[model samples]
Structure formats: C-alpha cells, structure tokens
Target: MFDSVLVAVFTYNEENKISEVLEKMCKKFKNILVVDNNSQDNTLKRISNYPVKCIHHKYNLGKSNSMKTALDYARINNFEYLAFIDGDGQHSISDLEKICNKILDIKNGLVIGFREDLTNLNLKKRIGTKILNKIFTLLYKKKISDIQCGLRVFNISEKSIKWESSGLQHYFADAEITCNAIKNGCQISQIPIQTITSDKFKGMNILQGLYLLIMIVVWRVF
Candidate 1:
C-alpha cells in the first residue's frame, strides 16, 4: 500500500460534495489534506469531524494556488508522493488507488488519471479539450490524452518539486503542470478513469477559452 502518499483535495465552496469526497479519500489513504480556497459556505464545518489536515486560505485563490499550498505542505511533511483530486465529486476513489499504485510501480514520473468518457461535457468544452490535447501532444512530442484531468499523482523528488503558475491564469494550470513535467523529462503515463459529470463542474466559457489559448502559446514561446 502507498501509505506515505498524501492525498490533497483543492476545494472552493464545495459544501455539498466535500464531505463525501473526504470520507472516501480517508478510507483509502491515511494522510489527506484539504486546501480550502476561502470558501464562503459551510464547507469547513462539514469536514470538521474528519481526521484530516485543513488549510484555509484568506481569499478565494484559484486551483493553482491551492495546489501550491498542498505541494508546500507535502514537502514540509516529507511525504513520498502527492496525489491531487478535485473536491467536486467527479473523481473516483478507485481511480485514485490506481494512480497511487502506478506511482509505486514507476517509482518516478507523473501518473495522470485520463477520463475516457467525454460525452458528458458540452460541445464547446469537448472541442477545446481536443484541440488543447493535440497542441500539447505536438509541443511535448508525447501522447497526452487529457490536458486538464485534475486527478493526478506525482513523485515528490527534489527535481519534480519545482512548479510555477499564475493565479490569474488558473484555467491552464493543469496543462502548465503537465507541460513542465514533460519538458523536465519526467515520464508521463495515463490510467483510464470514470468521472461523475455535473453541470457544476463544467469547463470555461468562450472568453476564458480564448484567453487560455493565448496563455498556452505564450507559455510555449518562453
């Protein structure tokens, strides 16, 4: 079992689903951390009874910042691996276990849970993800099935610890992380996962997608 792996869930006002997600995570992983992005709801209260570490931000920072917090925590605690899953009830605990097992087997690399079913997403999101995935594949010269899958496992080596992303450009943070990992010569692998679709977990709008495209181009240029 991957006992030393720290499971991190980055949440933002997910009072309705956070409790169930935490309960499932705690069942499989002994160490779990919840990084709350200054939620206004009773999210914190709902998770109070759970035996997990909680980091409440002063403001509603985006997912990138929340992940940075979790990464720092993992480093300080000397955890061997860091597993990140969205606070929304989309990601499956069984998939999480598969990711952890992949990390253990590989010993080093980024293991991403690639959602095979994309029929649930709207047409715009589906197109955007397809284009982004193709772009990433060409840029990194690696087959990246999903550029924005939130469920992932990373080996906490010194070299893999360094990551940078803008709080303003949160939409592409997942892509940025994957790009950095590939650029640094880390092995990237994918495991099939089933996602629970919800309207609450929909992708960005047209303007956000355009901005993300520009940011990705800029990221690749530099």
Candidate 2:
C-alpha cells in the first residue's frame, strides 16, 4: 500500500459506475478519497461499502473545486503525493498504478498519462486536443501529447508547481495543472495509456475546449 500517497477519485453523478471503480480503487490504495460533486444518485452509498474517505459536497462545484478539496486533504494529513483519477471507469486502474509507481520513483515529480492513440476519440475532442497541444507547446515550449488525461499523480509538498487551484475552470483543471507544472519547473513524466473508446467522451464540448484554449494562455501570463 502507498502510505505516503492519497489516491483521489472525482465523481459527478457517476452512480452507474462508482461501485466498480471504487471496488478496484480500494484494492490498490489504502487511503482513497472520494470527492463527490453532489452526485444526484447513489454514488455515496456505493462508496460507503468500500474502505475510503468520503466528502460529500452540498452542491456541484465543478472539477477544479473537487481537485482543490483533494489536494487540501492530502496536505492536511501529511501525505507526500496526491493522485487523481475520474470515477467514470474510463480511466484504467492499471494506468493509475503506473502513475503511482512513477511518482514514487522520482523526487518532486508529476506523472501525466497520455492516451497512446486518438483514432477512437470523436472529431471535436480529437481536433481540439491537437490544437490545444500545439498552443501549449508554443507557450510552454513543451510537446505533451495529452494534457487533459484524467489519471495523474504529483508531489503535493512542492509549492512552486501548485499554481492557482481555485477558479471557474469547469473542465480545464487537467490542462491547467499540466501547463502550470511545466511553467513552474516541475519534473514531469508522461506514460502512454491505451486510448479511450469514443463511448467514454463525457465533457469535451466546443465551449469547454474554447475556454481551455484561453486558459492555456492565461496561465502562462499570470
């Protein structure tokens, strides 16, 4: 078990999937934190069946706030690293295992998982990912294949790479955290994970993609 690490699973109306996800997560992580964004279903009840720490929000506060809550919990409890994964079951627990291993192997490091192929992604998500990746490379001088992959692990004690974790970034937290980590000189390692099937594309809309495009530049400037 990873005693120094806290594996956080973010949930938002994922009752249909949480049981299986939590079942797998509980086996890998001793300290599992479920940040439920006021799921309107039985996600919490399923979570209770597992040996995990659950924090139910009064209302849905978006992914960024959920991330902030997890990070705060890790710091307060003196965990050295914070790992985040989604509860949709799209992200593989095996990939998360690699991330946890990679983070522990390096000092002050952040491991971001990249999908090995993009052919399965829908047109909007596939194209938007390429455009944002190009823009991120231009601004940050780094070519990260997948900046928005949900499965990742990072050192929580390293303050410089922390960046600003609070905002209205409904779906931009992954990219924001990645760009900010690179901008602040955090050690980053990207692992190739199996590309998700098209059926798993949950929130990559035109508006969210546009907002992430703007935020990519915003994080670079301020």
lDDT of each: 0.83, 0.84
Writing each residue's lDDT as its tens digit, candidate 1 over 23-73 gives 888878898999999999999998797999999999988888988999899
Please write out the lDDT profile of model 2 over residues 1-222, one tens digit for every residue.
888889999998888888988888778889999999999888888889998999988988888789889988998999999999988887888888888888888957789999888888878878888898888889999888888887889888776555454446667778878887888888889998877562455686888688778878888998
How big is the positional error of residue 30 in model 2, measured in Å on the Cα after superposition? 1.0
Error of 2 at 201 (Å): 5.0
Q: What is the C-alpha RMSD of each candidate to the true structure, in Å?
A: 1.5, 1.6
Over 4 Å off in model 2, which ranges?
Answer: 163-168, 198-201
- The parts of candidate 1 lying over 4 Å away from their true place are 158-161
Error of 1 at 95 (Å): 0.6
